[model samples]
Target chain A: MATKSVKTAQRYAMVIDAKKCINCKACVVACKAENQVPLGVFRNWIDEETSGEYPHLRMSFDPEQCHHCADPSCVRVCPTGASWQREDGIVLVNEDDCIGCKYCIIACPYDARYHNPETHTVGKCTFCSHRVDRGELPACVETCPSKVRVFGDLNDPKSQLHQLLATRRYEVKNPQTGNGPQLYYLL
Target chain B: MREPVWEFLIVNYLFLGGLSAGLYFASALATWIQEDGRSAYPRIARWGALLAPWPVSLGSALLVLDLGKPMRFWKIFFHFRWRSPMSIGSWLLVAFTFLSLAYLWSWLEQDERQSLQARIPGKIRKRIPARVQRWLDLDASLWRRNLAMLGFPIAVGVGIYTGVLLGAVQARPFWNTNLVAQMFLFSALSSGTAALVVARLMDREPVELKEMRFLYSMDITLIVLELFIVLPYLIHGELSSLAVKEALAQVLGGPFTIVFWLFFMGIGLLLPLAIELYEFKPVILGKGTFHIQPRWALTAGGLVLFGGYMLRYIFVFAGQATGFR
Candidate 1:
C-alpha cells in the first residue's frame, strides 16, 4: 500500500507584503460583496497593531482571514464533515452539508467563519476557488491597489510567493496552535 | 454582558425543552416504580410521555429556524459528519423522539388490568384474552411495558448527549471540561423531575408526594455537586483566565446574574427543597404517607421548572458569548 502512491500536490497559499499594505479596507469590501457576507460580519479582517505613545504612535494593520491551516481545529471538531480542507490546502465550508451549529465558528482561532443570518449556514472565504479555477486570482488580490497580496502554488520554486517566502522573513497568525496556516505576512 | 435578542430566545428554548423532556421521563419512571393503580400512575406517565417530545422537538426546531438558511436544515443529515457536535446531537434527538413515540403508542394502547392479569398467567389470560379479544390485546401491553422500560436508558442518554455535545469542544475553554456533560445530565434530570411534579399538580391527581420528595432531594444534591464542580473551574486562572473571569462575572454580577441566582438557584433549587422538606417531615413522623396541597406543590413545581430552564439558558449563552470574546 505504501508503494502505490498517487499523490496530487496542489498546496495553494498567499503571501501578503505587510509593509506595502495601507489598511485601506478595500480587500474587506471586495470580499464581502463577492461572498455576499452578511452585514456587521466579515470573512476577513484587518487587525491593527499599535506601539509607542499617542502623539508618536505607529500602527500596523494585519489583515486576517481563515489561515486554511494544514491541521485545522475547525475540521477536527466538526461533527458533520461539512468543514473540510481541500486537496489544494484551501479550507472551505460545504454550505449544503452544514448544520449551522456554529461549532466551526467557535473552533476557529482567527474568527474567520460566520453564521450567515441570511443562509442559516456557516460562511467563509473559499480562496475564490471559482476564480482560481478560471485562471484568475482571488477578489481580494485582484482588487488590492498596492499589490500587497500575492497568491500562487507554494510548491513551485519559481513562483513569486515561494521566492518571497524563501528570501524574506514572514509570520503566520497564532503560531502557538501549530495549524501551519497557508497565509503568511512579510514583515 | 448584554446578549442579543436572538441569543436570549434560542438559549431559553433549548433549556426549557431539555428540562421539560427530562422531567417528563423521570416522572414516568417514578410512576412505573410506584405501581399505583395503572389508572393512577400510568395516566400521569402517559400524559408526561406524550407531553415530553413537544418541547424538545420545538426547541430543536427553533434552533434551526434561527439559522441562516432554515430550509437547508436537512443537509445536516444528508452529509452527516462525526466531527460536529450539532450533527451528533441532532441524530440523538431524532432517535430519542422515535423511541419516545413508540413508548407513547404502547402506553396509549395499554390494558392496565390485562397487564396485571399477565403477571398471574394461564387461566386468567385465556378467560380475558377470549372475552376481550376485540377491545383488549395483552400482547401490545407487554410490548409497551417492555418498550417503556427500554426508554428509561434512552431518555437519559438523550439528556446526556446535550452535555457531551458542549463538553467535546476543547477549543472553547469555558465549554471544554468534562464537568459540562455531568452538569448537563444533572440539570436534565432536575428539570425533568420538576416538570413531572408540576404536571401532576396541574392535573389535580394524587401528587406522588413520596416520589416527588425523593426526586427533589436528589436534584438538590446534584445541583450542589454541579455547583462544586463549576466553582473551581470558574475561579482557576490556568485555562483562558480572561474568558473564564469574564464568564464568572457575567453569571455572578453581570446581566445574567439575576436569572442565575434569583431564578435558577432560588426557584429551581431552594423552593423545591423547602416544599420537599415539609413533605418529608410528615413521612419521617411515621405517617408513611403525606398529603401536600396540590396547588402548593404545583406552584413550587412550576417555579422549579422555570428555574431549570433559566439555568440552561444562562450557562449556554453566557459560555458561548464569553468564549467568543
Candidate 2:
C-alpha cells in the first residue's frame, strides 16, 4: 500500500513593492469586477501621497486592502461571529450570519471594511479567497500592470511570498495596532 | 472613508438603555431605603419600577430594527464572545429586561394584583384552584427586596456598558477613555431620576411634593457628578495623543462647540443644576422648608434628560468622524 502524506495548513499573505506602482488603479477596478463589488464602494483601492516641493517632488502610490490581521479587531468586535478568519489566514465575512450591526467597521483601524448595501452586510477584501482555494492569484495581484502585489503561502519556505519576506525589508501599514497585519509593503 | 454606520437609531438606543438602567437603580435604591415613619420614597420606587420596563423594551426593538439583518439578532445570543462588548451588551440587555419585568411584577401592590387577577378570563381563573392561587401569592415585597439587591449591579453594568461599547473601539480616540464609562453612569442616573420626576409631575393623581424634592436632590447630585466626569473627559482627550486631541477638538472648539457648550453644558446641565440648587439651598442649610414649583421641576428634569441625550450624540458623531488615519 502507498504511504499517505499529510498536507500542512497554509499561511497566506501579500507582499507589495509599491515603489513600482504606476497609480494606474487597475487593481482597484479588477478587485471590484472580480468581487462584483457594488459601484461607489470598493474592496481595495490605491492611496496616493506627494512629498517634497517643486522640482524635488515625488509621488507614491500604495495599493491598500484588508491587512487580514492575525488579531483582527473586526473579528473581536463582531457580536455574531460573522466576521471571522480561516486557519489559512484569510479573513472573511459570512453574510448569512452577519446581523449588519457594523461594529466591525467601527473596530477596524485601517477602515478596511464597508457596509454592502446590496447584501445589507459588511464586506471587505477576502484576499480573493475563492480563487486562492483553486490555486489562483488574487484579482489585484493578477491584474497589477507593474506586478505590485505578490501573493503566496508564507508557511511554505519555497513559496515566493515567504522567500521575499525573508529577503526584503518591509513594513506594515499600522504596526502600532499590534494586530499582526499580514500585508508587507516592501521598502 | 468610514462613514458613521450608527446614526439616530443608535443614539436613541444608547440614551434609552442608559435611562432604563438608571431607572432600575432608582427603584432598587428606593426599595432598600429605610423608610421613616411617614417616608414617601415608596411612591418614587413605584414610579421607577412602573416606568423602567417600557423604555428598554422600546429601545431594544429599535436596536433590532437597526440591524442589517434583524431576524439574525438571535444569533448574537447563541455565540457569546466575552471580548466583544456588543455580544456582552446583547446578553446584558436580555438579562436586564427579564429582571426589570420581574421587579415590576414584585412591586405590584396587593390591590394592583387583585385588579390584574380580575383582568384574567373567568374560565381560566376557574380552571386554577383557590389553593394554587393562594400558594402563588408568596411574599412579593420580600422578592422585590431581593431582586432589587440582585439587579442593582446588572443595572450599573448596563449603564457602564453603553459607554464601554464605544470606548472599546480604540480606533476612535475620543471614546477610548475610562471617563466615558464614568460620565455615562452619572448621566444615566441623572436622566433616570429626571424621567421619574417628569412622570410624577405629569401624573394624573397628585404625589407629595416632598417625594418630588427627594428626586430633585438625587438629580442635583447626579448632575454635578456628571459635570465633573465630562470636564475631565475633555481635558483627558486634549492631553492625550494627536488623534485624541483632534477628536476632542470637535466638541472643544470645532464644529460641535456651540452645541456642546451652549445647549448641553449651559442649558442642559448648569441651568438645571442652578435651579435645583436654588430650590434645595434652604433645606441644605437647615434654614427653611423644602419647596419646588411644578413648572420648575418640569423644566429642570426635562433639561437633564436632554443633556444626557446630547452627550451620547456628540460622542457618537464626533468619534465616528475622527479615526486613526
Candidate 3:
C-alpha cells in the first residue's frame, strides 16, 4: 500500500510581465471577490519593488501567487495531509483536513499562505480552479485591465502562457530555494 | 510590522521540550555510571527521573492549543507523510511521551518499594505479603534505564527536530541553515545541566561543590558555542543574497535589532555567560573553597532557560521579516 500522497501528471504554472504591469490592483480585488478571501488576508496580490534614489526612482509591480512549485516547501512541511499537490500540478490546501498549525505558512518562502481567522484555517491562491475547470480564465486574469497575469499549462505548448514563455525571458521567485517555483516574471 | 504567526506558545514549547529531553538523558547517564558512591548526582538523577515527563507533556499540550483548528489536530496521526517534517515531528512527540511516562512510572514504583522496605520489620520482612514482596523485588531504576536506552535517541530526536522544523523551510532564507540544529542541541544540553544544578542547589542536598562548579563551566562552554553558531546569521547574511541580506538586516539594524541584540544576544547569551563565569570561579580570588549559593545558581539557570526561549522567538520572527518579492 502506498503511504504517500498521490502524484500529479500536469504541472500548472504562471508568468507575469513587470514591464506591462500598471499596478491597477484589479487582479487583487478580483481574487478577493472570487475567493471571498477574508479581510486582511489575500489569495493573490501585487508587490511593488522600488530601486534608485528618490530623485530618480523606478518602481515595478510583480503579481505574486502560490508559485505551485514542482517541489513545494509548504507541501513538505504540512503535518497532516491537509496540503497536497493535485495530479494536475495545482498545489492546494484542504481546509477541513488542515490542523492549521501554520507550519505550511512558515514553510512558504513567498509568504503566499495566510491564516484565515474566520475559518481558523490557512488559505492561499488556488489559481481559480473553479473557473479554470470551466474553460475560463482565472478571476484575476479576467479582471486585469492590463492583462499582465498569464496562467496555463507549461506542457501545452499552444497555451498562451507556454507561448509567452517560449518568446520572452523571465525569472522565478527565489530560484536559489531549488523548489523549482513555477511563478515566472517577464522583464 | 506584521506580527509573527508564532508567539509565546512556541517559544515556551521549545524550551520545555529541551528541558525534558536533557533531564531524562542526564539522569539515565548518571544512573549507568553510578557505583556505590556518596555523591549529590544520585539526588540529581532522582529529581530528573521523577520530573522529566511533565514539561514535555505540557509543551505538547501547548502546541495543540497554538493550532488554528485544535479539533483537527488528530488528523496529524491519521495520515503519515514521510516528506512532511511535521508528520515526523508529531510521531516523535508521541514516542517520546510514551517512553518518558514509562521511565517515570518505573521510578515511582521504586520509591514505593523503598518506602515499603523501610517500614517493614526485619522479622516480618519475609512474612510480608507475597504480592508486595514480588513488587519490591523488581528493580525499577534498572527498568527505567532500559526504557532510557530507547528513550535517549528519541529524546535527542525531539530536541533536534524542533530546530529542523524551522531550518527545513527553504523559503525563509534566514531560517534555512544547517546551524540551527547544532545551536539548539547544544543549548538543550547546557540548559538541561543548568536545570539540574538549580534543582540540586535548591534541595540543599549534600553535594560536592566541585560538581556544581563543573556544571557551570560546561554551561559557559555551551553558551560560547551557541553564540558562535547564531551570531554569524547576522554578520554574514549581507554576503549571501540580496533577499537574504535584507532579511538579516531587518534583524541586525531594523526594528527587530533591539530585541535580537538586547534581549536575545545581550540578556540571553552574554548575561548568562557572565553569570556562569562568575559561578565557575573559586570562592576566594584564585584557589580557594568552591562555593555556589542556591540563589546564584537559580539565577544563572533561569537566565539560560530564558535565553533559550528567546532564540526560538528570534528565529520565527526574523525568518518572516522578509519574503520573496
lDDT per residue for candidate 2 within A121-180, as digits (tens), equals 999999999998888999999998899899999889999889999999999987776678
| lDDT score of residue A16 within candidate 3 | 85
lDDT of 2 by residue, B40-142 (tens): 4887787899889888899899999999888888999988888899999989999999999888988887888788889999999989987979855654766
List, for all models, the DockQ compared with the true complex.
0.44, 0.77, 0.65
Q: Give, for candidate 2 chain B, the lowest lDDT window spanning 10 residues.
A: B31-40
In candidate 3, stretches whose alpha carbon ends up further than 4 angstroms from where it belongs are: A1-9, A50-57, B37-40, B109-139, B210-214, B231-239, B282-286
Docking class of 3: medium
Q: Cα RMSDs of all predictions? A: 6.8, 2.6, 6.0
Worst 10-residue lDDT window, candidate 2 chain A: A172-181
Interface RMSD of each: 3.7, 1.0, 1.4
Which 10-residue window of candidate 3 chain B scores lowest in summed lDDT?
A: B31-40
lDDT of each: 0.70, 0.88, 0.79
- lDDT at B280, model 3: 66
Q: Could you tell me the TM-score of candidate 2?
A: 0.93
The worst-scoring run of ten residues by lDDT in candidate 1 chain B lies at B1-10
